[model samples]
Target: MNASDQNALVIEGGNQLKGEITPQGAKNEALQILCAVLLTEEKVTIHNIPDIRDVNQLISLLEDLGVEIHKIGDNSYAFQAKEIDITYLQSEEYKAKASSLRGSIMTLGPLLARYKYAKIPKPGGDKIGRRRLDTHFLGFEKLGAKFNYNSDHKYFEIDAHDLRGTYILLDEPSVTGTANVIMAAVLAKGTTTLYNAACEPYIQQLCRMLTSMGAKITGAGSNLLKIEGVEQLSGTTHTMLPDMIEIGSFIGLAAMTQSEITIKNARIDELGLIPDIFKRLGIQMEFRNDDIFIPEQEHYEIDRFIDGSILTVADGPWPLFTPDLLSIVLVVATQARGTVLIHQKMFESRLFFVDKLIDMGAQIILCDPHRANVIGLDRQIPLRGIKMTSPDIRAGVALLIAALSAKGTSTIYNAEQIDRGYQYIDKRLQALGANISRI
Candidate 1:
């Protein structure tokens, strides 16, 4: 659903939202963790699972694979892959379901590791940029898996008869790619040393959970990871961290709306560089235990480089600001007091949403597909709401933020894109006094 989808968000803009909002479980981490459940036959109890579209879609795909799924709570599930239907991998139904969301790509590692065969249609998600599966297939090939792609059917398959681990130096530090390789390596016969791995908190959480399931893994939060393959794994209960991307988005929303909002259970210790990066935008936030207190501000200023140069906010590997939050940052800068360069180095098409913001009266120069120069209005002229369409998940949320701060009402089409990542976003924002409704 790109723009013609009937799932739209009608937002009455210029409302100063208040109260506390708790973020849902981390969506990125949940995808990898849920796939990891396939590695062990025991019951894997996972709490803090978000009830979002993509995750739910993946859960349905797991059900198609004959994994025993039991919902223990509103946001908790116990999964047992004891009787996986391997034959389902060849069915047309499996192809369509697996192609619906990009998260299905993670299942390949576990299925190939345990069953020695796995096939999936080319997974789909946001069309922000080109995301290749080379790292995943190349890593698998290094671990004794024969990779094949049937271009006619738009699906790929892997055959792993005898899995043995070896040294792997990834060409790029991709989080999901790293996760797929790690999951496959955990059940290999020999030691697997993975260098240039993605050290995001999501990957670290996966490592911890895999360790609890009897996998021998070291370097949970570093680029260099070593895993001694274990014969089998036992299930264990694990809790997911709050979505840091949501936390960052909430902070941006509070500043954009000038609302006094508190983000509960943000797990600040785990939010590395997020708070400080927002501080770069001059958005003041207070940390009270695990909660983040965002005070209403009439005007916020953007900080410049120490050499009196324009501050350039760029995305890179972890510990650096994330590319996922760059859209939110771009929106937050629209109403800020100064000019800053938003360099979205990761995905070329990610910065394309600025055109919608420009139509809504934002002073943004799309320097190229990769960079944008946002000269803020500083709230002197409030943004005028207009009808727009959400292109992807992060951009959808970013446009929502822009609409919340704009004057008059705004209608956003294709809101299902937003629902893919954020859990009940309209309801949660409504709880915080936002004038938004999903239609």
Candidate 2:
């Protein structure tokens, strides 16, 4: 879905949303898992898959490569790719559309590792900043992969027949860059050591999936990853990690509306530093085993630093607050008690959406393209919800968070942006007792 599928979301503000909402599987993790099917010749079962646009597009690409896919159950898929004919993917239309998604570019590493050749067009995604594919190419080249490029096209020629693993230190800890390298190194001839790797939950899930397929990997969930190549890969089953971004979004939604809600099966362990990040904003939460419950509260105050300095919430590699959820945090910060700095070092233009929040009557200082200083309104005057539109995936959810907290009805156009990352957002928020509807 694109702009044509745009819907008017009428959010009746000022009501406490109350109920339990469970997060779907991770979108980034599911994308990497889907690409793993190209590695082996056996049947593979992937569980807890998120039904989103990127995943659907990759599945379509897999089918076009002669992979037999069956939906076994809800959020579950059975994949059998005994043979892949890369010749079928040589068409410009297919390559262009396939590479339009960031996740689609990950297919290149796996395809080249297994087939020794892959034709991938320039990748496309949200126009938030300069997202480079050089990191991916650099990592692949370290593993003996050669590349050919033209003004309109790029193809990798990897001789996996003599592929040798080597040490690769990425220029940046790019998520897709790390994923591409991990997939390629899994079947290389020797051991590979990756430092400065993206150790997010999605990367950990990818490592776990590869381990289950008989590849030797260690130091998952950390910045360093060790991979020992195997002669062949046997297909196996692996489930996706819970989406922490979705969990944080719901937490913000509940806070904005003064709602009491529970996020069930939230996989708190995987969200190592996230809870404390929100805690800095003084948003209260109670953990009932695996569920995170937000109690009904009148107001949440932002906690200042020990030196009486303004609060600073920044994103880093894994075990830090994810950059993907920084926008939601910025929105939440706008409603808190004191001032806070929302720093998004990864994406330059992610903080530009603060203008929309300001339009809704929030006090925020746009520090730059990558940072914003949000002064909490403390509910002095409830946000006057107004007409708005979603800009990107994370910003879209942030806009929804702001709208739900506003005083009047709000319409968010291009809601498909939100749908790309979060699954069944409307139905799930409704179950949490939000007065939100789509027109």
Candidate 3:
């Protein structure tokens, strides 16, 4: 955290917020789709784009590559990549900006497929754990791209004279890796089959946008995806889905704060397992068409198994509970009426933030790096506000929830971490009666 990042959020807790709010555009999805803009020479207009640090950094990177970007609206933009300067990627300044965001890694596929070569610096984003790019590199290698690592430059260089698609089975369901492989395979010479692929809604949205740009892809929402290489891709307009993670965060916030809140245009059908997972934590939500209405409740009891065992909330790949929301869920469970184990199976360092919650008076047993058991307070005890640092994006929001529900004022340092994913979060929460001020 630098001088700019020294900004903190001061929150007055114990407020019952009541209002309706809509989630911003999907940040993860925008990262992938924006990289896809490099595939076409024509203009691509993307709507519902979130105004955040990561997305803005990526858009700046696009500009450095000579992509003509015009802001059509506050949340819309038009991009044209007809005059890409791939050599700019090798500059020190460009490398620094590229390395500032993890999403910059996605640019590898589009660069390799279009320019036949790409140089990417090691990516930087929320230091949650070791996020490997091996799946992406290996996937590109399967599609006939040669890879080399320059230890001196601390970057990876890939080149492909002829990219011919083939069968690829990823070692893990890496979302960004899947998007990279799909983007590269879409412009290859032959058909591609990807098994054990990440099928998150973001990936599905990326595939749909690619399909609109003239790519042939099947089995979008499933782990197995088949893509037939096309000679060229045309530009097309794409509208992103609401950020499901933010929606889940808001749902958890409403429940933990005992507020009556409604999330508008939630796209409930696409939010697989998210609502049910919250419902398990004792959140009662009603779906009205596309919105979710969560009313104020005095008590919410965690559901137990039919065998009377404590329920465990674990994260897995898509169609399962998203790992991103596990932190939020863990925070919400602190106010519930029963005990539930939070198993964060994906990232190792994610559950380490439980120490912050425990310091704030929540009863949490940190079993290991991968799991924690949270015993609900049942609203019998109000959490005392305490100063803490924001660890990562999801965990930052979780801490914000804890701060809002705490008995007194709490200051959260490293506000930039929260700004990376959320758009004007403090102002948005303030609209709903949250006593938060960004300092």
Q: Poorest 10 consecutive residues of model 1 by lDDT?
A: 1-10
- Taking all chains together, each candidate's TM-score versus the true structure is 0.99, 0.96, 0.99
Expressed as tens digits, the lDDT of each residue in 28-92 for candidate 2 is 78888899889898999998899887778788888888899999999999998898988877787
Q: State the RMSD for candidate 1.
A: 1.1
Q: Candidate 2 — which residues are off by over 4 angstroms?
A: 1-5, 153-161
lDDT of each: 0.94, 0.84, 0.94
Alpha-carbon shift of residue 362 in model 3 (angstroms): 0.4
Q: Between which residue pairs do clashes occur in model 3? A: none
**lDDT tens digits, residues 339-412, model 3?**
99999998999998999999999999999999999999999998889999998999999999999999998999
Q: Where is model 2 poorest over a 10-residue stretch in terms of lDDT?
A: 152-161
| Alpha carbon lDDT at 320, candidate 3 | 93
